[model samples]
Target chain A: MLFRIIKRTDLTGTQAVMFRTAAVFLALLTSSVFIIILGNNPFEVYASMLEGSFGSVYGIKETIIKTIPLVITSLGIAVAFKMKFWNIGAEGQIFMGAFAASYFALNHADIPRPALLVIMAAAGFLVGGLWALIPAIFKAQFGTNETLFTLMMNYIALKWVTYLQYGPWKDPGANGFPKIANFHDNAILPKVFGVHIGWIIAIVLIVIMYVFIHHTKRGFEISVIGESENTARYAGMNVKKIIITSILISGGICGLTGMIQASAVNNTLAVEVTGGVGYMAIITTWLAQLSAPVILLVSFLFAVLVQGGAYIQTAFQIPQSVASIIQGMILFFVLGSEFFIQYKLILNKSILKKEAKGGI
Target chain B: MDFALLFAYAVHAGTPLLFATLGEMVTEKSGNLNLGVEGMMLMGAVMGFQVGIATSNPLLAVVGAAAAGALGGLIFAFLTVTLRANQVVSGLALTIFGTGFAGFFGQKLTGKIVPGPITTFFGEAKVPLLSDIPFVGKILFAQNLFVYFGYVAAIALGVYLFHTRKGLNLRAVGENPAAADASGINISLYKYTHILLGGALCGLGGAYLSLVYVPTWKENITAGRGWIAVALVIFTTWSPYRAIIGSYLFGCLDIIGFRIQDLKIKVSPYIIDMLPYIVTIVVLVFISMRKSKENAPPKGLGNPYFREDR
Candidate 1:
């Protein structure tokens, strides 16, 4: 059969949604092969996954905890992505933020609860912002590649934290086990509805980001820059300044996630505090298409996958990486499906007729 | 620390980076910027180790690793080249998928030793006449099969990229796909071939990590070497010959921290561990500052080409 790929100029909203849903279903079906390979029933595994994530109050709360960092970091990534800036260094920014917050939490345990928490948040914002600023400056001044620059920064930030954990910041009383001192009670974030206040913070940020992106002049400027830097320049926008400012805000929010995770989740700074959430957020943010409300929904679903994946590890003797495998497959299917949405394959009648006539 | 020993170990360490950088360089030359080298490497490492364990053949393990890596490249090519999806996101997806795929299957192979025959086959051996030479021979010629392959690959790629007509055509496609297409060069064919070939090389690099470096199966055996290889491509300005030097320098940086600790230096190893990444950033900044056209990336890089749009 002769077929030609044609671009679809008028895809509807419902069609796009349908395509995405099908992609998710296809991803699950594809991943079922692996479950079958591991000698388990795909349906049973999936049922347990759903049950583990939302079956009980504790499971739901843990899922929420997982969602918090992802939502906030995705929001931060969405802002930079809106400007076409590839800030893949959220992992580093998160680490720097956690490190900054830990500094205050460990050193100023005597400070009152509310003030200390406020101070830690501010410090995380500042440190994370500054850490990200280095690359933005280089990118603006020299037109350097931001992707590699930011990626390199992740390792630097990680190694710096590792240094502290084993060297200057090591808790001497812990019998030489390499670890930083835990945060004091005053530094920890309080709980609301069985989840840390980070959930409330996440919701507030979502509303603020939605308004900021859709309503504000700065947001419009960002979109313009994203579409075309030349267009933004022609419109009298200070491209360099806007890039720096947006990245600062972006990195600062990611840093705040570090503070929340450190204070509320880990109750202290640790190397695994981010738990690959920074990289995971990049995926979620892209999947969310840079929308704040959509980011919330996407991150929640991903958190369920993660929580359920964890649950299956214990319940079915499956490897923890099965979750990652499923996530990756889902991303692949969804990413591939975007093509089908934008274009379609149609049988070429003329070519088919020509071939038929030649055959005759 | 013995200088000769240090240099020798550096070459051994840099073999994987050399292979990966060369592969990525070729792929980029085809106008595709795939950021999933780390993921591809993991896939290669795990698969190569598994093959070695199952078959007990070093040659088959190497081939298997390259094939696995090419499979990853095939996926990226399909998404970016065929589907015309955003290259960056697709590459990231490839990375996530490859890493997860490797980890999922590699769970059983963890801690398992590479088969005796396979290890022995890949073990270091001295070239007869070359080993008789002085310090340089010991440092360069006395190495495993992977190191030798890296040398040959770098030299061959350098020649092919500069001295061959096909290489010129590839460069033309990267520089201006429309012009290349106008000249009757099959853009997709060139991209698919180079990308797959590049992936194969990346796989060999990963296999080197498992079959030679540690000689055991382990999850994430490549660590960040794949990323380092990506950076090295920039540091070399996409030159295969320059990749040799860049990879060795990075390899030295990778182990210098431990070397300093051996010298009883007060400097923390963690701080030293930061050097390669820091050096990469500094080199990138310098490269950008130069503003040399020769050092610039391919013009059509990271963009999906559609003939209809043109």
Candidate 2:
């Protein structure tokens, strides 16, 4: 018997949802094998994972804290991906954003709190946008591979931050071991409830992004260009300008994420400011298929996994890296499941009959 | 300047990269751009170290490393080739999987060094007569077995890729899979074969670090060498021979960062360390700027081929 995969004419929304759900289920099912091998009950492990993320107010807050960066960065990535531009430099972009914001806050410590925050945000937005612009311009003009370019940019940005923390920006008063200087009271972001205002910004941005992508003329241009650059040109859209603008916005939002991480959360510039959220955002954003609402949900799920993963480290003696393994398995399953969503496997009836006759 | 010493160090540093770059090059030539080289290398490093520690056999370590690396590659091929998924996403997932998987197991080997016999097994095997030549001999002929293996592998693969019938077919598969398929080539089989082999080579490179070069287990020991290897494939314009030279040049650049730091220069060493990646971007731009067909990446690179798809 032989089977061949045939492409489907169209995949409905329901089927996509079903496939995605199945992928998640299958991922968990496969993950159970690892859990069992580790001598932990799969059910108890999963229960603990949930409890670790949402068991207490602090756990919930931590999950939200993680989600803020993941959501904001993924949103920024969505804009670029929507335009078919692979902006993988969100890590670098986030660092630049954090660096710029910290620089502003450090130099303008005398400024009023509100004005200082605004300036820091602007600095972050502009710097992050500029960092992203380098590759976008190169990509638009020379057709350079942005994926590798962005990847390289990440290490450069990381090294730059490392240089700062260890060299000029090191807090001298702390003495030895190296550390970035903390923001002054006025420079720090104020909290509304228990958590900082980063999540508030993220929520507001989500609404704006939804409106921007669905209702705005520029958003229409982005979708058109993403679908086909030639088609966009034929429609009289300024392709280069659109590409530049989209990535700038994408990068600007990523910068905002960095700014929040620095001013609100870390309260200082450090190499760990981005905290691998930039890379994680890539997976979440891609997994969400660039949908704003879906990104929020996916980001929340990822944040839970991260927060819970950390919990498992202390709670169950599981290594923190296990989270990455679980996430990777989930991504692999979903990525593979996409094939089934797009195509159908068909058994060859004629081949089966021929096989049966030959056997007889 | 001690040119011979630098050359020897450069050869030592670049061998692992050469293994990885050659593997990535072969995989890329098969039209699947697998970006999980870093992950594969890390897994190879950890797995190879663990096995070497257990068996006290360098040969077994080498095989173990290759097998672990091939497993990483197999995961990639299964997702991208068999399932017709997005190559970039799948590659990234494979990377995440490999890095974490390696890291999770690698904690046990913290601060552990390779077994003594394993090191001696991979130790320098100075060529019989070639070692007698004054300066050039030490730089070229005097090296560990893995270094020699790199040379043999590079030359052999270089010749095979350009001169052999199967190599031509593989090139054809990369350049134009649909056309190759029409001409009776098994596109999927070629892709899976090369990608798996490429991954295994990357694993071997990782193993080299643990077993020969550093010979100690350190977290993220590959530390962007795998990435540099990826860039080297592009920098060398996808020729295995050029990969050898490219890896050495990059290896020299990498070693120079530490060498200069030892000299106590005022400049931050990290800035100097940024040379390879920055140069990679510049080389990529330069390569793109030339806009020649010969210098171009394989036409079908990063695209999944379905026989029915027009």
Candidate 3:
């Protein structure tokens, strides 16, 4: 072999940052080749993306609105991932949460706005948390594969939502088109400043999550469990309880995101309500390494990509799938970069000896 | 419903899944839990569809799809095997990438005239004497070449995994990479080879969808079959023969939905669509509940190997 990889003891903070930046730069550079193949300038494409997401006040608002769900979902996902629980069912949780909120809104249309919002929030959070807990409980009790379990739940939830839109919950006034009924005025989250209150909630949650993960004993226990179950057990940590609670929090938060998104953004439950954010949040949380502030920033960037990707669809005739491709590349490069951070490539032993002997 | 007809329909619907599940089974046997089969299959679907349309050759399309899927596997290998990234995350990234790649190309290919020759090529091939046999003939012999390919692949894999020396080594690698390494097996070599081969199979599965199953280019044409294949691997308890059975069963469940809808049943189509997923969860729960040691997953699964640490 020309080169051998040697595992490093650790990477410094600055070195880690450099590796991430390099990965991002390389991912963009690689994606540029695809742009050129399509007869487009990568720089122009990127500039338009930036402009589309941040150019006008409307663009900014849309970006912020997009960021709200992403930040909340990713932050919620971060909780489960912190314990290495692998809760990939955030999509389902979000849907269930939205469904619960919608159910509340539909039946309680006559209720006061403020009270209805509270009930919807509670309903959404509880439903989402319960949905998430199913997999967590199974994993805790039976040691079942949660990743597959959670993933299966997502399709089930999606199908359930689709059924609702087409069947019992279909809006009677949509003239036979399969559309879920719009939420009552009381169900909608009121806008604060410009965007809905989801942004404020997300910000507050971020701070709470940061404090919970870093400064709390429970967070410390989660880190230990993530490192090793045996070690956590030896330390007298109730690993099962922690795992269940963490996933509940993760799922619950994702569900709350659904409620906010449904009430504030879409104003109706649809099969596409989650908009792939659940899957996107999985990557974002992983990319952020479960850091709350980093998650917020990463999600913001993701929002820009999504908003801008849609923008470029009409502005430049580029398919929105281009954004997915770019996002995948970024994630791939970043994932690959972790290898470089943990292990450095070096010349193979024979080559190293030969080079050293030949050197003056 | 005619039992034999439903069985035949199940076989036809199950071919793609059988390929994917077998592919994933092989990959998992190398201790790498790849969850990107969906993406790889989609990539294969688009590429094979394009090639089939261009050349009008089913054989060429299968080859093309396999190659496309292998390309996906190659990326996954570099990330998980060489770079030692998280297998799950890398697999997810591969799916996202593959899906995007397929969708982009698929969008361009749609509404364009390339003359689909593979459609004619995939016409049913009823074995002359075999077709005359009883119900078994209709259920097994009367099918497209792809269906036979799936059967042969499954049986071949079953034999290979249980009967061959190399197969034993591959299993050993998955079960205990460190032990395999100590016993002079090149763990990385087996991991990469099997992962890539598995990827190719997944790609073929995807190709089967575009070139054989649906016979058209459309966005997300594979639907959730890739994920279903992943679940089927578990349902089969990692056995190729079991995978064949599990795939057909799931396939029947899927087709039954449409069959019921055609019969004017009052059931919502979406509810019927949920059967496979719900069944998967139920199977997963049951399998775990059994807690049988022999049915357990590979011990070294999902963990990166660091030789120096050991």
What digit string (tens of lDDT, one per residue) describes model 2 on residues B119-204?
A: 88888899989977999798978999899999999999999899999999999999999899999999989999999999999999
Each prediction's Cα lDDT score?
Answer: 0.90, 0.89, 0.89
All candidates: TM-score: 0.97, 0.96, 0.96
Between 1 and 2, whose TM-score is larger? 1
Can you list each candidate's DockQ?
0.71, 0.70, 0.74
Candidate 1's C-alpha runs over 4 A off are none
What value does DockQ give for candidate 3?
Answer: 0.74
lDDT of 1 by residue, B1-310 (tens): 6898899999988989999999999999999999889888988998899899999988999999999999999999998898887777777778888888888879999899999898788787899999768888889999977799899999999999889999999998888999999999999999999999999999999999998999878878888888888888887888999999999988988878778778887898899878878887888898789977787778787777887779
lDDT of 3 by residue, B1-310 (tens): 7989999999889999999999999999999989899999999999998888778777888899999999999999989998888888888899999988997888877644334566666778998999779998998899988888888999999899889999999999999888999999998899999999999999999988888787667889899788989888888888998888899998888788767867778898789888778877887888789988677777778888878769
Error of 1 at B111 (Å): 2.3
Better of 1 and 2 by DockQ: 1
Ten consecutive residues with minimal summed lDDT in candidate 3 chain A? A1-10
lDDT of 3: 0.89
Q: Which regions of candidate 2 are displaced past 4 Å?
A: A9-12, A356-360, B262-265
**How much is the lDDT of residue B63 in candidate 1?**
94
What lDDT score is found at residue A31 in candidate 3? 88
